[model samples]
Target: MDLSTPPPDLYGRPRADTFFRFLTAFGDRYSPALGGPLLRRNPRRPFSRPTEALQLVVTARRRVAADVVELTLADPSGGPLPGWQPGAHLRLTLPSGRERHYSLCGDPADPADQADPAGSAERSGYRIAVRRLPDGGGGSAEIHDTLHPGTRLTARRPRNGFAFCAEPAVLFLAGGIGITPLLPMVREARRNGLDWHLVHTGRSADTLPFAAELRALDPARVHLRTDDEHGGPPTGTELLAHAPRGAAVYCCGPAPMLTAVQRALDASPAASLHFERFGAAPVTDGEPFTVRLGADGPELPVPADRSALDVLREARPDLPYSCKQGFCGTCEVRLLAGAPDHRDRRLTPERRADGALLPCVSRAAAGETLVLDL
Candidate 1:
């Protein structure tokens, strides 16, 4: 079979052959029969400087809600895990050998929250939660179904894209599983005595993860809205009504909720809005284009349906990439020429003007050829 052109699925998306190869590689590297030595082989790419993958054991697992499962990962060596701040997430290499990013929801400062206090060793652990997405990608389902207590997995240290800022006042709006990253932020706010409030919504009370924990922090400041109870979701205007002018607002949720929040804050003066998305920014069909690697490398064609990262990976498999949805800056490349259709949220307007582009989810303009400093 020609690996380049696989049959398109119902959505007309081409299936890359590299996925199968990755699965084979995953098994060879992580197979239990091979033992700890083989698993110790670092999976970090040369380009992913200062970041490396570590082996973690599942010390505990429990269902937090109807479809959500919370996992506690600890270092097998019984040592403290890497330190992280609020709004940080870990990239775990799953059973299928695919990488998935999950937010760290547990308290970073508390050693007991992360480690086994029973042992004499100063052990620490990291806590993360996953919501099963049956109809969506396979990562969440694999975590819920395959991962368990005593299971071993590989994960990268915490990388934070959504860093919490100290302001006069803070308002957080979360929808469904999006609450994972914001939970720690709310805790830090309270610990520091900063005024903060959280407006969380889900399909129903049963589906809201960490409902009790959030309410315990502060009932008056936390607002819970359920579609089943409220007859519909709360509007962004309603959630932001209590926010004072110039307050810092952070939101994470489904696209609709984020869009609504953006619209609500469009007219507010002096308010700073921050967002963290689990998926790529909504993009229309892109036009076919070509990219030149380095100054003299071959000009590779990027299909409209494929990402630049996929095309570049054909020649450079070592290219660092995680969360290919463009939320992560691992696949960022310097643009020497041509206009980029700036689709990634990670790059600021100034960085885009400075010729920075994330190849994972971004594309080129019509009939434009991009020269990359690969």
Candidate 2:
């Protein structure tokens, strides 16, 4: 670790210190400070927990567009789910029995949404933006076709996989549905009076929600790029035009957009680029191996052809999983001893280097005797 400066987080990873301060306010309660009767040991990790389940009751639902559904979920058990920071997401049991993970797009500090009775429930509830997927028989479709107001579901408590940094300003890039998780981070940055810019893209303006909000922000701070604008094509070049140096660029769109951003960021340092994905991916460089679960101590065969999730389920059916695509950290395991070859898209390289493994896509790189947390 470089001693030239203070280390970021415990991972020696770079982090915007203020982000941690903000996270401390969210469901991250500890004794002697946010004094409560509840005894605690885990001390409420923001982006650090494997998973925390919540009972979510859909209080409101609105069709923001043809494919997009905006939903408000509150306490199904009438209690606070957990503390969450911006860029947090929850995986849950949707109305169709299909599990899906949706980013929490609400302000973490908004007391109106807080689960505390003394705190406000008006703005404290979690908001999820779900767009109907053409092939997603699991998440998007269930939220679109089956869910409505009064629908109750079980969800993993909010966990922030994507975190903001303290860089001078931020450049947020959103593609298609990738815009959901980014909304809160943008709002927080703007509210904090941070100097940041946003480059939003979609098929057309009509397909993009928050057009009015984006425009309301100073024109210098926001730019909209639509592929099918009436004036002409949105000019794919416009997407690259806003690439600013020294500014952290976050992209959340389709694979094409992500690829474009990846290539664009190649021109800059790796730390300035961040992106999110909601698709299938192979565990790169994986080889067939065996995993030893801590509880049962059973030897399960994991093949190069099989996903770690698939092998684990066959060995331990009761294992928790949501958004098997790796967005939710429910299946995250602690690497008691092993060189984990991480392939998930959720964690930063520094954190992944710290020995956490998401069984959904990550696998063992060393020998056998992989000890798991659950």
lDDT of each: 0.80, 0.68
Candidate 2 runs further than 4 Å off:
1-52, 77-81, 114-123, 230-237, 268-271, 282-321, 324-374
Give the candidate number with the greatest lDDT.
1
lDDT of 2 by residue, 184-278 (tens): 77877777777678888788877786667666866788887777764643333456556555677777777666766666565553346776776
Runs of candidate 1 exceeding 4 Å displacement: 1-49, 114-123, 268-270, 284-322, 327-359, 368-374
In lDDT terms, how accurate is model 2?
0.68
Model 2, C-alpha of 46: deviation from truth (Å): 19
User: lDDT by residue for model 1 over 108-183, one digit each (tens)?
Assistant: 6554664554532223888899999887547888888899998999987777777776565899889999999999
Q: Each model's TM-score, in the order given?
A: 0.69, 0.65
Clash numbers, per candidate: 2, 9
- Output the number of the TM-score-best candidate: 1
